[model samples]
Target: MSGLLALLDDVAAIAKVAAASVDDIAAAAAKAGTKAAGVVIDDAAVTPKYVHGFQADRELPIIWRIALGSLKNKLVVLLPGLLALDAFAPWAITPLLMLGGAYLCFEGAEKLVHMFAPHADHEIEADFDTRDPARLEEEKVAGAIKTDFILSAEIMTIALATIESPSFWMQAITLAVVGTFITVAVYGAVALIVKMDDLGLHMAATGHTSGSRALGRGLVRAMPRLMAVLSTVGTAAMLWVGGNIVIHGLDVTQLWAWPYKTIKYVATELANALPAAQGLVQWLVTAALDGVFGLILGVILIPIATRVVGPAIAAIWPGKST
Candidate 1:
């Protein structure tokens, strides 16, 4: 009887420790996820464009495909890749981050060019107009997943940095929890945002109350404009975030400090100018400067990417340049 009671005590103690570990993981994940909120927002903002022109019925399916790809990017690819990188070549993280940032800048600038010069369509846009629907959808999903991989890398890295130096298993668990929670939160929000128009249509059609129907009609009318605005915001966000990442990476790598320092100095001066709204002014100035730099870098890289890199990839991997 005494031995059984002792064994029961040991089991109870083990259960308590397990419960505590779960609580710790949850808290750590939340904190780490919060630190990556900017990238999370950018991820959500950037995704809607991938589903922009699809049929109403196809919209949710497209989003689901992209969401699944995003989950794979984070959990299957990034989680393991980042963990290995963190364990082995910690110094390489910043440069790789800068590479991802440059890609975002390139994508954002490409969109800007398309906006300004509709005659000069990108390969993807051309494919969309000319190719089979299935092919276009495949390309769109692939592109979205590629972009998500970059952003997810940043998010996971940020989360890893935010978490304190716990045990190896603890760190891994926290990162996994953070990655899963963020993936669900971000894509879930994206799903809702994309389906909003459909919801509005349903409400407009079926609502018994006149006010509810009227509100639904307003929602339906507003969706197109909202989507357009969201696309523009997404583009700007890509630039802002991409530039910010590169600048910080440059600072971290000790390659160039001037851009980050100059931006801070200028933002501080502007904040002083508008002391009443100093925080807001500072943030705006910093973001504007980052975006401008991102655009410049992207524009510079465009020709190099198109003329040199694209051809190199095409030569190596036949159908991939498009």
Candidate 2:
């Protein structure tokens, strides 16, 4: 009887250790996920554009395909690489992160420039409108997955960097959890955002009650403006996140702290001016500076990316250029 009791005690102890490990993973995952919020928001905001011209029925399926691709991008392609990096060359994380941040800056700044440039339409939509529907869908999904790869790399790196634990398996578990959660959240939100108008139209046309129909009509009317807002938010997020990374990287690389300090001063000034909106004002001031710096950096990078880096990449990859 005593031997059986001892065995039961050992089982209970093992269960407790398992529970503790699970709790640790959950905590780390949450921490890492929160740290990657900017990239996650940008991911969600950027995704809806891929399905824009598709038939309403095809939108969700396309998004599903893209989401699946995104999952594979992160898990199959990126996850293993990140783990390998962590195991072999953890020092490579920061520089790669900064490069990803620079790319975000370039993308966001390009959008802003297009908004003001007179010839924006010449290249903004590109040849997307000319392709066969199926081909276009496939291309767009591929493009989106490519884009997601960059963002996912940044997100995963950020998540990995934010993790405090020393155990490799624990870090792996946390990163996987973070990756799964963010992909679902981003694509799920993208699906909802892209379909809101159709849903509203359906509700307006087929709702059983007058109030329901009215609400549906309102949703349909609201969608365009909501999308515009999301685009603006996405751009801002990209610039803010990008600028923060470059500035932090600069500080890390022993360049200077003036940029960060200047932004902090501006944020403080803005906060002082708006007591009621102190937090918001501070955030906007910081974001605006970050965006401005990001734009400048992006402009500088544009010619290099287009004329130099782009061609070199095309040369290396041959058929893979976007």
Best TM-score goes to which candidate? 1
TM-score of each: 0.96, 0.89
Q: Candidates' lDDT values, in order?
A: 0.88, 0.83
User: Which ranges of candidate 2 are over 4 A from the true structure?
Assistant: 116-129, 273-275
How many clashes in candidate 2?
0
- Ten residues in a row with the worst lDDT in model 1? 121-130
Flag clash pairs in model 2.
none
Which tens-of-lDDT digit does each residue in 1-322 have in candidate 1? Answer: 9999999999999999999999988899889999999889988899998898888888889888888888788888887887788889988889999999999899899889979986784565676663477888888889888888888989999998998855778888998898888888888888888888888888899999998898889888998898898899889988998899999998888899999999999999999999999999998999999999999999998888888898899999988872
Candidate 1 residue 142 Cα shift, in angstroms, is 0.8
Question: TM-score of model 1 relative to the true fold?
Answer: 0.96
lDDT of 2 by residue, 1-322 (tens): 9999999999999999999999999999999999889778878877777777678899899989988988888888888889898889977767777887798788778778777784754543654554678777877888788778878988998898899999888988888899999999999889889899988999999999999999999999998788788878777777777887787777676678789888888899879989999999997788789888888898788778766787788899985542
- Candidate 1 lDDT score at position 61: 90
- CA deviation > 4 Å runs, candidate 1: 121-124
Query: Quick one: how many clashes does candidate 1 have?
Result: 0
